[model samples]
Target: MEGIAIKLNKNISLSLLALIFFLIGLFSIYTEVFSGIDRMILDYKFRHLQQEDSNKKIVLVSIDEKSLSYFNSNGMYWPWPREFYQIVTDYFHESGAELIVYDILFDTPDFDRRNLSGTMSDRRFLQSLKRSNNAILAFKSTENEDPAVDLSMNNEPLIEHYNIKNDPPYKEPHLLTSKPLDKFAKAATGLGNTVMSPDEDGLIRSIHLFDSLAYKGFVPTLSMAAFLELQPDTVSLEWTSSGLRIGDQNIPLQDNGDYLINWYEKGGVRNGTFPYYSFQAIVKSAIQKMRNPDAEVSVPPSVLEDKIIIVGASAAGLGDIKSTPISSLEPFPGMEIQATILNNLIGNNFITQPPTWIAILILLLISIGIPFVIAYSRPGKGAAAIISILFAIIGIGLALFTYERIWFSTGLYLIMATIAYSGSAAYKYFAEEKQKKEIRSAFGQYVQPEFVEQLIAQPNLLKLGGQKKRLTVLFSDIAGFTSISEEKAPEELVSFLNEYLGTMTDIIFKHSGTVDKYIGDAVMAFWGAPIDQDNHAELACRSTLKMMQKVKELAPQDTNIHSRFGIATGDMIVGNIGSYNRFNYTVLGDTVNLAARLEAANKKFGSNTMIAEKTYEDVKDVFYGRQLDFLVVKGKTKPVRVYELMGEKSDPDTEELEKIISTYQKGLDFYLNREWDKAMNRFQEVLSLKPEDGPSETYIERCKKFKEEPPPKDWDGVFHLKTK
Candidate 1:
């Protein structure tokens, strides 16, 4: 998880971020069982319509080129000859046809409009009308609400010859009437409306099956046509939570009665749903079928065989495009489209809703699995491929389920997971990369190159917040730097100090310690963070000894370079420290203060190196050092022992070590016993052996003081410093 966090910070992106939030939101969802199942009601309805059209077909007496040329030069559109209707009906009657349907509306009679009141051509429709008892005629709406008079061919009649004295509105089912063709509609097979749903762009979207039943219980228009034709041996119904169902088929109905005729593209019905060969060609085909009963004809029998065919133009100018699931184009008439829908449903090309538990399970699988894929995937091409693979798995799964009568949340899963993985990866990558840059930029300037790498490798060493760490602190000051500065002008002094301090700091960093701070000629430093160093004490002590030697080497080379070095070891807060607005990567504690005291204490002796008791304890086995007297430095309660680390203190002959130990112990014993004379003698001997020893010299002065006063009986060897 940590590694992933680092990676995400480095590689975060906007798309991925959106995906992450999206997935989070998705996961939070408590999906309900069968939540989206209501939509399947629509699926059942379309299938029901298709089933209705399965046994119906259309017969056209197309007014083709041959018929139109003979009738008039105008060739179609307006004034269809009354006698032409006679020939078409006569042809269907001569053959063994079940029903004859007129796709054309005889709304405004051409003869009547033309004032041909006694025309011979107009009188022929009377014979055709009487002979064709199984004929269905079409009527179009004129958007007129007035029901005053009836208009017929050319000019004369305003009366109903079909005797509508006791007939209902649907008997002739005029668009103006509200009621279905009750007793009158029963005289014909079925009545259908030409209404279509519109697309988003205002083109007709669907053909809403408007069945002219005495009541709406007759089901949809196409379904009514099928029921009228088949008149199934037994009608049965099944019920679902959605609504009533006829057998296995469900008819979708909205609260206000809609077929859910969502539009598909117009070309969707080229498989036998195109317009029949005009009104003229149909007459010729019928004549041929009549003249040669035993011969194969140009017209296929299935063309008119049990197929509920609604003849309506779905073309652009005819205004039949509708919005649908497949696209936003104008769809076919609601009746024809319903026919197609029913067929498809009856053929089992439909999807259904799964149980609620199944939906919940699917969502859980996606949410849990996708995140893991994102987390485990590597970066670059491999990550991209994994993301793609996961996407395909989800997508294919959804598609398969869809085909198998189920709706899966493919889009949601893809969008969510892609965003999540991408977001986490992008964020982790960018964050870590930024930290690395900050590490390089921050420490790179003041630290050694290798140390900079180490800091970057583990930036936790230098935390954004301060933390406590045990570090070895070192402080060094120029020996008499003020006096040395006095010998030189201020400008030369500043330049000299910069050159010297800069070089010393370089050595400090080379030993893997941070240059904590600089105070005039004194330099403070520590080890053990910004990176851990368990051997930090050893490293600091070694650095201090080297610094002292280097100072000596520089002292004579340039009188301005001699410096006193201080080394201390203990617990100290060694990370960024300060107010939020201003902080420093520095160490502070009693041990740190002791280190400063040690630097100043170097002045009491002519020596260049001074180490506190803790530091000495760490390196005494490796370095030669002399223990000094205890003193309670300022800012500390317990008196601390100090030592002068001379050089590498490997094994020495017992003779030399014992002699030094003997004299040192005797002096301490005499001093504690308050024997001023004996203590002075031992101190003088110790100083004689090690002439430049600060501890022995200081002890001698203490002995002289005790001899002069010789008063206190409870006195012990405890010294206090005025400066910390």
Candidate 2:
């Protein structure tokens, strides 16, 4: 029984612990509490797994420090004349460039004070765009509404040229837009928005391919615009459960409708991954070509031929530097991000994540599985298992990310697994193992060796510290023990006490009771603690009767040796009591005290065994016992009804004892009613039937005394014993 209880408790505790960790895992994933750790891990993977080469079709024209310095030295400050861009545009066009994408937002008109006709520079740039027929200008999408910007003049042309079919729109509409002046926007082959919103950590990881406009329909991104310009027959865009599909290619999208970018090796004018040309170098090439038409230039025409040219600033002062997964210490330029997006689109390469349900399923498996592994296995084996699980999760996550471009939330799984293992291990150590030690040390001698082993196996049977419980306590003492000790020699007395205590203890143990302590010739014991027993009262009463019978059988023929016992059942505090250096596992409270008082009260009634009413009530169906008195013993204010336990109902003498008990109860009733004559007659009848009955004789004497001096009218037949 104790083993079953302990096992149940352990199972419940471990299950609850696992459930708590599972909930924590779910909450952490939903809230992204450990996203920073995940991001750091992703950055590490990016750094280690970066490609050695970049896309060959994309060329970067960087307006870097050298270009800015050279232009500044040549009397061209920042924001050089639009005619300078016209020269570069014509050079790329003549070189047979597939597409020229400007990541610079030319929202405001170009006004050059040095030019005689300020509008002439804008006209020249527009003419170059018209002649090239491959220029895609950048625009900005804003949340703030701008009523001042006219929408009627070129709205139809812009929408007709750039709008793609958005079947089942995936993103919210951008209510407003900021684009180049009417002249430039109308003259450009196409327009794309360059809106790059970073994550909360300020790292740009994804971009939206198409954003719906309030009055202008859908506008594609700069990369999307370049793709469309190169493939004009593509039209429809559709949103699916996993991602978006444009023409024949499918692009993965996050839950927020943003496409994750699969970055290549960092490339710019400073690096050689992509074909990088400085803005000043391109301008010099154009100027040299105009000078002689066949002049040799710093940048050859073959470099730009059939390649997508991305024009944007790379200088730190331009405020286009962005933190990407590849590098944060040295950031990627915004122009490079656009080029990377274009490369991904062209190559059909993008990073994807598994569905939320898949992550939750994995979390649930680890959260529930790891705890059981830790709980059932040995400590070393459990630790090994946990480490193996951790490695497996990390390995699988890295493999998927490397080969399949699939990112799984492995950090969340690791957190859940670590917490489950540590929590289960800690509970086993502190709650189960510690309890076993306590039970072994406390009950080693009080209980049988086999019982102690059982207790150790199921330590949950005992609550080591003080706890209130309903238990039956017993106290026994040898009647006239002091006189017997005085008559015998020291050795004889020791031998007699040893025999008597040993016999009584054996009887108590036979009934599964704990011998609490022995005080000289007296023994104290209890049932129903350290373990639970439904019939604790019956066990205590049976032990009391057996001990009394054993005392009679063990005594010498001439010597009169008798033992008195008192049993009680009630709520009492049972635990290890006394100082730390020396403590006894004992029972305390009024229940224990009452049992001791009842043992002493046996002398007054001349009864061998007495039990409190609570104990009698619990065992009445099995044991034959009669009411003794409403006793308020020494140091107590409340009266308790006590009974003298005669024998079990199955005993041969039970019938005779019941007849005597009936007569005695009748006399007690009459005596309490103040009918002295009637009570005396009943008592005489009881003595006639059993001449040696001490209670009947005592009641007769009580009736005579009460006849002479009647008890007070308020008296309730309660007997108060004045001595301990």
RMSD of each: 10.8, 15.4
Model 2 / residue 422 / CA error / Å: 3.5
Q: After superposition, how far is residue 194 of candidate 2 from its true place, in Å?
A: 1.2
Q: lDDT by residue for model 2 over 369-453, one digit each (tens)? A: 8878887786789899989999999999889988877887777777778877788778777875677676767776576566777
612, model 2: CA deviation in Å? 42
Q: What TM-scores do the predictions have? A: 0.56, 0.62
> Which residue runs of candidate 2 sit more than 4 Å off their true CA positions?
1-9, 52-54, 144-172, 175-177, 446-724
Name model 1 segments beyond 4 Å from true.
1-340, 343-409, 412-441, 457-461, 556-561, 649-691, 706-713
lDDT of each: 0.55, 0.81
Error at 404, model 2, angstroms? 2.2
**At residue 303, what lDDT does model 2 achieve?**
86
* Winner by TM-score: 2
TM-score of 2: 0.62
